[model samples]
Target: MRRFASCSLILAGGLSIVACTPDQPAAARQPVFEDVSFRQDYSKKYSATDTTLALSHVATDRNGAVQILSSRGLLQPYAGEFLYPGTLVADKSFRPLRDKKIRAISTYRQQRVYLDDKAVFSNAWAGTLYKKHTLPNAKHFAGGKDFSFLVSDGKKLQYLNDGIAWEGSAPAGLIDIVYDARRNAFMLLSPSEISVFSATEHTVTTFYTGKGLTCLALTNNAREWVVGTHAGYFTLDAASGRQRGTLQRKLPCADLTAVEEINGKLWFGSVRGAFMIRPDGKCNYYACKRWLPSDTVIDLAPGADSSVLVLTDRGLGEICFKSMTLADKAAYFGQQVRRRHIRHGFNATLENLEAGNLGTGTLDDSDNDGLWTCMYLAAEVFRHTVTGADDALENCRESMDALERLYTINPMHGFPSRSFERRGYKYDSEPWRRAEDPEWDWKSTTSSDEAIGHMFVYGVMAELMRDEDLKKRAVVLMDSLMQHVLDNNMYLVDWDGKPTTWGKWNPEYVNARPAMVGDRKINSSNIISMLQTAYYFTHREVYKEKAFELMTRQGYYENLMRPMREITTAPASADDWSKMLSEAWNHSDDEMYFLGYWGLYRYAFNDTLQANFREAIIDHWQAERPEKDALWNIMTAVTGAQQFDLDEAVWYLQEYPLDLVSWKVKNSDRGDIMKIDTNFRNQHTAEVLPPDELEICRHNANRFGLDGGNGGATEYSAGDIWLLPYWLGRYLGVIGTPDVVKP
Candidate 1:
């Protein structure tokens, strides 16, 4: 026997108190909030300690301690601790140092300072420090295994090898020099040219020429160099000096200041931030307050394996590329859902509250609150099924109760309002007013979208949840809603005793339209799935008989099998319904089709018609690939379609930005993207806007739209867009479960 919590009574509208017993099972109690602290801990554990000195240069010593050179002193991290300031020679202007033969060479006001593991040695230009008794009057230095080169006043280049000195002249307007040990040569850079000087051959040759050159680094093979210019970076062949293609995307900032090769990846630092270009050409950008202390990146250097040390004007930051995983990401987002996204018992479609706190505003009251809440409940149900967590089960129960209230709050039997509130609850606009019941308020004109969401969650609960009481409640809700449609001629009757605008799915309504109308196909597909799910959960033969009747007489199965390409807009018609239904392609229909497909493919059909359903699903999925929608791909995977891109699904999860607030994002001025022709049915451009530049998006939004804004009135929640795909991917075995220890 399951344990139940105590019941309570509450007064409504100053009437007599009424008994309100919330049937919460013992296993489904309130969840204790856990701090989402992984990212913070990872940031703290990997970042470098703060230093007060104004740092000018940074490099990694052989011992893996990052050496810091400031205007007045030197510092180095000691044995995984904070940077310890080292003693500075008085009145000396120190040039940046380079590691050579497990030693670092630092130049102090025309004097050479050689630092090894044990001690630091200062030698004047006239002193006998090595076989060569003279050091060049240089402001910059580059070192190799057996030679050290210096650029004096950025023009005269001199190299010391085996106590012998060789001299060369840099191109006019020289800026910096670096040694490529693999090629046994020194690369000199000016504002617009690169010159490679070979000390052995006593020759200097211009390697590449381009305008706005700022920084360069050789590849791991020493066969090509990555050149960072003010515009963007590209690769140049070291031997032929020929330009390769530009990177997959331009760096975040145009004023490139530093570039380095770290663990086979090219790290570029610019005035805006730092970015890493993998060998496969995928770019990962790091910037803003979460990833860096400041946006002005000074330099980038390699640290311990796979870690890159970032130098900014404020301080140093170290990031380990492999420290984070997908599970950690899921945990963080899950907490965001619980904290900022929940309003009352429902999930807010648009969260306008401050972080970690709920706000008092009209934004919390959304028309589709029940729908979003149901989707979130489905995600938690899947999570509970996968992990067997008590908290996830509790969350699902809470959302389920909220969804049920949408039906019971309205006086009309089995008619679910879009949303409901107390009589005094404030609403700013239309669709929300006092219901027929003077003590309550409800949103009217609820459409088919709400019906789809309610049925989807009801079916999932009946299948996955273990509680017997909840299962019985789901059955009752399904029977009530399905019977309402059946009794009312297959149309959802609204509170006004008439069919809602989009709730018509009867044969007379759907089959009267042309074959090219999307509504005809979508409505037929939805009603079949609804009847099939209703029968499967309720064990009612009426639902199964109705499903068969529709398939045989109404031709719903044939309607659904029509190829997606054939569903195009027809010519304008005289009738208003026909004109509206055949006007253009509706992405809302895509949402309805995929959501209904959960039941259409999963529970509706047996082995006989499975192949036909699979064909229809694949046809729709193939047409949607250009949008690269993760939700559609993961949903289609339930039908065992091998053509779906699993890697792209993971990329979508990872590339989704952390900012969940619905900020206005505009991209009309971007230069890197392409434009395409637009028609009434197809509005997608040639290329998708990069994820970072897009607004907080939902599955229903136009994926290829170039400009979007949320009106700043509400912030969208990521619960459906992110949590649905992630959990569905887990349920289908397409995404692996990480070793995440429960709190």
Candidate 2:
């Protein structure tokens, strides 16, 4: 049964609907499986064939020779007549078969058969010799079970039973026919109509009518028929001729050529490619050269082991739906993160290394490597908690070690560097200087974002890590970082012996701004959370004392409690910093605010304070839902707020394309998406571009933007965007663990 994440909070009434449910039931929620489809060309595999098969029509003969009718003439497995060879044949005048204008072919009782404008004939090698037979006035032929055959002569349909007794003509204007054993009847189809001729009733019944209906197939349940039209396909009730549902709105392409049901799945072949509709009505598309020999799918045939044989104009190919699952996809992408994106245990990189191999260079090119590494470490820690995997624990330890180096490598006590590198190695043009130790160098200009990330991970590690040494290490780092701020009057001192820009969280700087300024509330909320986290892990009274001092004396708590919707752009001030703060939304600040909330609501506040924090978090999340950010939604779920958009969070994760390469994606001229006007900062456009067409995206990219950078060149790691939210969802009990079936 399909199950979704549940919410307990009543969003409209602001009341708790129920107590939090136990984790076991939440863990048992079933995951909705979806198909990730890609296309490829296999035409090159058959380039050495003797004839250029156009694949206008394909059928397997009795001897298992896959024959294809091309513009060049009849081509099959063998060319010679008496001693038939396995080589491809193109001659129409071979042996007893001499029809150049053949329309269709079928296998009947181990006999190779063909139909032309005038007759139906067969040339079979029987009893060590070739035997031939021809029946006149046959235009087309369709074979059914038990050697039953339906023959058409341009205008009439006739059925021949297994005993070779001819059934009288029943209908005119018939274009194609197929037999359904379940109904014990023959289905006759025309360009715009379908009729069922039941043998028992000896009556013809019209089933459906639609313009340009091209193909028909019985559904897996044998209760309905999938009728394909030029625009799309729909389901029609077999017993009553009532329309079940039309799927034109759900299809990716409309110009369908053929439709077939194989193994309970409906495969629609079209001019653009093929679309497979599952029993559950989920659609998966295969059109590109990566999955198809050509975009023009002529026909489809069922193959062994639940696979489908695709006949395109270029060649034949097979699609195996069982080859991979969502678990396999997640594991493959996780491997990609480790192999291609990791830099010294950090799972996030600004650009992928060339050739799947690292060059002789330092991995500290990204200034925020420490922050990205901390986020990755938090993901691993959550993974370990959920799955109890020793490898995930080991990964967390390694990443934590790298994160520790960011603080220790710098000379200033308890101050973390933006990033560190080996001596004399430089690729980026960011500000850098040699450390006190001669062997390495570290970057400067660390911002508040790094601090918040450090504290967030520190809180999580202190709670989740089982090893005593790791726990102590986390507490020590928390103490040192918090003490640095306390000693330096709430500012992170840079290498130049001054407060770095964006590192000022002191009461003086925060209180000087108006309440309407975003930084005023953001700084107050972040500092309170940092102090709370420092106190929670270290059990230090000074941390709590400092937190309350700011809240009570500087109005920090009230500032943070202001409804997010009430905070808007403030009037410009004379000072440059104030003027900058008065501008419209800074999305980076949104990233920092949500990231800091992990500690703010989870570790800092008691039950009473947390209730108020939940209100603030919900308001912020309500404003952020328009962006459809998975990270923000997942983070909000940790607060246990009802109506947190859990479904949209999962949709974001599922809709995110598998391609993580940061190719340049431009969407300014796209005609398919809706465009709206916006006044928010950093939101360049209102178009919600498809994931595949957008630039290689990360969590921070605007989801509604029309343009992305990279020039089709660099690709970034999807670790932070994918792994973080996925594991967080698991840890928060929003995403259930999938059942593992060992091979």
Q: Highest TM-score among the candidates is held by which one?
A: 1
Cand. 1 TM to true fold: 0.71
Query: Weakest 10 consecutive residues, lDDT, candidate 1?
Result: 38-47
Compose the digit string of candidate 2's lDDT tens values, residues 414-501.
9988887788776444578787888888888898988988898888888887767777888899899999999999999987889988
C-alpha RMSD between model 1 and the true structure: 11.1
283, model 2: CA deviation in Å? 4.6
Model 1 residue 593 lDDT? 85
Candidate 2 versus the native: TM-score? 0.65
What's model 2's overall lDDT? 0.66
Candidate 1 lDDT, 73-185, residue by residue in tens: 45554322211111222213334333322233443333445533322344454444443323233445666544354444466666655543676666887766777777778
Clashing pairs in 2: 39-290, 39-291, 40-289, 40-290, 40-291, 40-292, 662-715, 664-712
Candidate 1: give the clashing pairs: none
